[model samples]
Target: MPDIISIGEILIDFVSMESGVTLAQSPGFLKAAGGAPANVAVAVSKLGVKSGFIGTAGNDPFGRFLKDTLNSYGVDTCHMDLTDEARTTLAFVSLTADGDRDFVFYRHPGADMMLRKEKISEDYIKSAHIFHFGSISLIDEPARTATLYAIDIAKKHGLIISYDPNLRLNLWPDEETARKTILSTLNLPDILKVSEVELEFLTGIRDIDSGLKALKDKTSASLILVTRGIEGVDYVYRGERGHVETFKDVKAIDATGAGDAFVAGVLYGIHERINEFKDGHMTSKALQDILRIANACGTITVTKKGAIPALPTIDEVKRFLSERLER
Candidate 1:
């Protein structure tokens, strides 16, 4: 049985090395595996965890490549679906000279959004220790309902629920609907991960503390993790709260999947019973360990250039930890 089950979109990201000066401007593109949930699965697997991806993809070349990539990373794809209605979702990312990115989607209701309620098998969700999801699948029909249904089942089975609002403004019809729906589901998660910008947008509060308070008051999630680029991660647990600084000084090439890596690190540490020092209580020591490991993972991710491909192996993470410890 898989220890982690991630349910949501699985697609291809075609990132541009150059910026678009105009609508007709074309830049050199690099194809890579992407999708928030898929990245989580790869991250978990690379960290020596038993992880699985449950979603749909097109019956096309890109879809096959996605499937093959997941298997190569040691993620179980037994619950993956191949659909004929739509092609795989493609995201065209354009990066500026400052390393900022803007995205243009090529989604016309792709296969990932076509995941059906019927395709969600009960056995799959019940077997996992944690169930993870994001908001992209909540933007569309069949998939929207399907994702919610699976969450319900996972909750019923008493699994730890993790959510990431991983917001994409281009995918949603309107900001209001996205804000309402994403905020509404916050209460259902045991752990929540959101970027600083996401916290602001979701709560309509510019201050991190105010936004975090609003989220906690609404969701009552046991743990709330807020990620800040370069600065590192800020976490709020039931009994502990603080910021964990970056593990090392490393030049970041692409930060596409750094948050996902942090999530994977948190889950990995928790699953290995590394938090036992806290004895089920959110003690300061436990929080420190979690933060340190998570920072190391995130730092490793940024050193590489892609999402899934950037996930570090166990040895790599250990080396990072050792290097940091020696400093």
Candidate 2:
């Protein structure tokens, strides 16, 4: 059985080769395995944790490649289903003039979105120590039901539930629908991770403090982490809050999987100290240490390109932290 299980979409990302160009203007595109929950599972597995992925993939070469990629990273995929009803999800990404990403998605009932509730295995979910999910999969039917059902099983097994909105505005039919659907199940997780922008989207407050306060008022999640680009991470554990500063003198090239890598680090820490968190006992210093590891993992990810490729292994994270300490 795995220590951690992440459930969501795992698909191919077609990235344009040319910089500062749209997809039409790009010379060519490169294929990469891209998905938020899968990235977190891979990152956790890479850090020497027993992580597993529970989701659906298309019955195609791309799906096989995705499975192989996770296997290469030492992530378990025994429960990852492959469906023939729909093709895999695809996202075409290109850089704009200002270095911002412009994305176009092709997921009209993608195989990942076809994850049915009947296909979900309660046994697999019960076997995991922690459960992680994203908001993207909750946009539609079968996947939405499947995700919630799995969460219920995880809860029954006393597993820690971690949620990250991982918002993509374009994927939703409307902002109101997205906001309503997400908040409807917001009270499920023990941990919630979101970016500053996602915080605003969730609570309609731009300020992290007020946003977090509003979220706490709405949800029962005990721990909430807000990642502030270069500013660092602000976290509220139980009732106390703290901040961890971002590493200085670091040059971030591609921030593709930075957030996932950070989440992986946090999950790893929780897995190691599962009893403490389950017992509702944690010190401010202990929480800060977890955030520091997560910050380093994100820092390492931003230094390289791609999601899974950029994620650092356990040795790499330790080396990165040790080098920083020496500096």
Give lDDT per model, in order.
Answer: 0.84, 0.87
Stretches of candidate 2 off by over 4 Å are 96-100
Where does candidate 1 clash, by residue pair? none
Q: Give the C-alpha miss distance for residue 51 in model 2, angstroms.
A: 0.9
Q: Report the number of backbone clashes for model 2.
A: 0
Clashing pairs in 2: none
lDDT of 1: 0.84
What lDDT is reached at residue 152 by model 1? 97
Deviation (Å) of 201 in candidate 2: 0.8
**lDDT tens digits by residue: candidate 1, 106-159:** 888798999999998899889888889999999999999999999999999988
Best of the candidates, TM-score: 2
Instruction: Return the lDDT, model 2, position 64.
Output: 88
Give residue 152's lDDT in candidate 2 (0 to 100).
91
